[model samples]
Target: MEQTANKQTRLSQRVRSIQPSGIRRFFDLASKMDNVISLGVGEPDFVTPWNVREASISSLERGMTAYTANAGLLELRVAISDYMNNRFQVDYNPDNEVLVTVGASEAIDLGMRSIINPGDEVIIVEPTFVSYAPLVSMAGGVPVAVGTTAASHFEVLPEDIEAAITDKTKAIMICYPNNPTGATISRAKLEQIATIVKTHDLIVFSDEIYAELSYEKDHVCFSSLPAMKEQTIVINGFSKAFAMTGWRLGFVLAPPDLLDAMLKIHQYSLMCAPTMAQYGALEAMRNGMEDIEKMTLSYQQRRNFFVKTAKEIGLPCHKPDGAFYAFPSIAHTGWTSEEFAEKLLIEERVAVVPGSVFGKGGEGHIRCSYATSLVNLEEALKRIGRFLEAHDIRGN
Candidate 1:
């Protein structure tokens, strides 16, 4: 027998310091419980439509499995270009300005990686997606979180934006039809942010994956601002709007030089998005507006029901103007968000994500995704009522 010396290989210091996403803990716990009605996830419950799936299947049959160029299939990029122009009035040169990514998730990661240098600060608005901070950290950037209140309907004020800026600040990270809050930036608001960004020469990383899902108004693209366009990277995908999450297809639009550099990074780091999904996205661009209309209408109906039911159940939810999430104040419950979430899962068999999981300002709130069936929504609200009443929580 050979004797071995003790040794260990440790992770990189950056990797070691980063913690796993807070969004997954509730999900892991909820999975083991029986008869649980969970609204804890951000993903839609819908399957990719038959046409989109058929397009993927057709690609498989044709054996287009090998890798294509790093920037993605030309036809898909062209489609993306046209799609943006038609919908958002932002024009991108598909050949030199767009790079397909693994998902909006990876698009976000790559977008930050391509921009930030060590110690540079990335401004993030809360409660935002959980991925932004870690990815910023990974790119050697410091995260500066600006917390918006429920009283403002979670809007990030321009004064607050101005206050959060430092000389180290490199970019503004924004997501709308925001994840946990369902809050969106209006045209005036987007312009205001763009003006500040232009004045400071700061880059804007705009994640508008939920653009098509807005119920109150049409989605605004920040890149549509001429002064902001040159310094902005618009990252969007076919996920939320078209119910194509697992398809893992997304694209980014940047200035010519940034697109060129990002394509090289994408080529080595991610290679290419799944080819079949690109074909499906091509179909989505061609004929999926109706599908978006259909899905958005359904989501809006569910959103209405949830806002009503949740407010009635002591959660004090606002009627979301966009995305299918209700960010409700649970202040009536003496328990903190995590505690409320834990007891609800164990006792009432209903699961909602603790808003605090998103970041600092989220403590007394909870995010309940309405991306589920109407029947399930009704049942979950009633169970939440039972849980609140049993715990002696008062309501409006």
Candidate 2:
């Protein structure tokens, strides 16, 4: 056989060097295996509420499936504005500050693209969402990852944020009521961040996708701060709270100039979020919040159970104040996070995401998602206990 030339095999170095998302690789593998109780995915397991589905059906029946304006359906944008005000104590004009995109995922990408110039630095606090770094790279920006440890309960400290800054630091991408760790900053801490961003005149992309799932106090919006509003872009969506992950509906709220640039990108890249999704999202805003509250209560119940059980199994646990994830340190288990996850899935049929998949800071931890049923959570914990015991790490 003739050898292929380097010329034929050439690809973009960025594409070649970048690793396939660790989270996605395991999820794809686990999904193909049977009897796996997967906690690997961070999405809600709940059904998209009935009313929202009905609205989508109604829209299709009424021929409302045609494309709307690039900014999104006016009624839905107005609904989003009203909902954010009633829920988060923030006031956005909706006209200039909001552009709907496909789920919070796309909004995050859009925000990154709008502000990033080639070689600009985007500081990201790690063990964060898998998308942030890759997306930043794709947008011709450099991603600076700041490590947060298990001892600090995975909250990004002001000092750490300060240390990661450089002349090229154009923005910071932050997700609160965080994904894998479920860590959150209190209002006082956010104020500290406000101070940093205000001092540096830095732009902030705050991903509050899990905002509604916060357990103790209601979620706070970065834009709620009068000073922060001008430099902040808020990315939120219906996926977590309304159980609408499949709907592909999310929106970006920003200052006018930023929103305009994002809309140009959106129009060119995706044109608009689905017309049917807009109608369904409008329904969710209008009447589906009680359903959201029910889901939050369920997740909180599961969180409480997982925390208690994880401790019983000798894991050092952090109580999550919001979101459905519980990140427990398994350093005592004599295994890396992925090793721990792999053993549990192979030996006992329970599935979870390794914390290291999130970033370097997550080396000794694993993310336990309580978005599954109570029965599953209990069974998974039992399997985890057995896995730990075999390693002589439980109940020492």
How high is the lDDT of residue 75 in model 2?
Answer: 91
Model 2 stretches with alpha carbons more than 4 Å out: 1-10
Error of 2 at 246 (Å): 0.6
Give the Cα lDDT of each candidate: 0.87, 0.87
How close to the true structure is residue 48 of candidate 2, measured as C-alpha lDDT? 92
Model 1: per-residue Cα lDDT over 29-110, one tens digit each: 9899899999987888888788888887898899988887788889989999999898889889988999999998888888
Please provide, for model 2 over 1-396, each residue's C-alpha lDDT reduced to its tens digit, 9 standing for 90 to 100.
235556545766666657888887678878888888887778899989888999999999999978899999999889999988988888888788889899888998888888899999999999898888989998889999998876787788988898889999999888899988999878887888889999999999899999999998767898897699898999999888999998888998998999999999999999999999999999999999899889999999999999998898887788987889999888876789898888888888888888888888888888888999999888888888888778788743
RMSD of candidate 2 to true structure, Å: 1.6
The clash count of every prediction, one per candidate, is: 0, 0
Alpha carbon lDDT of residue 25, candidate 1? Answer: 90
Worst 10 residues of 2 by lDDT: 1-10
Our tally of clashes for model 1 stands at 0
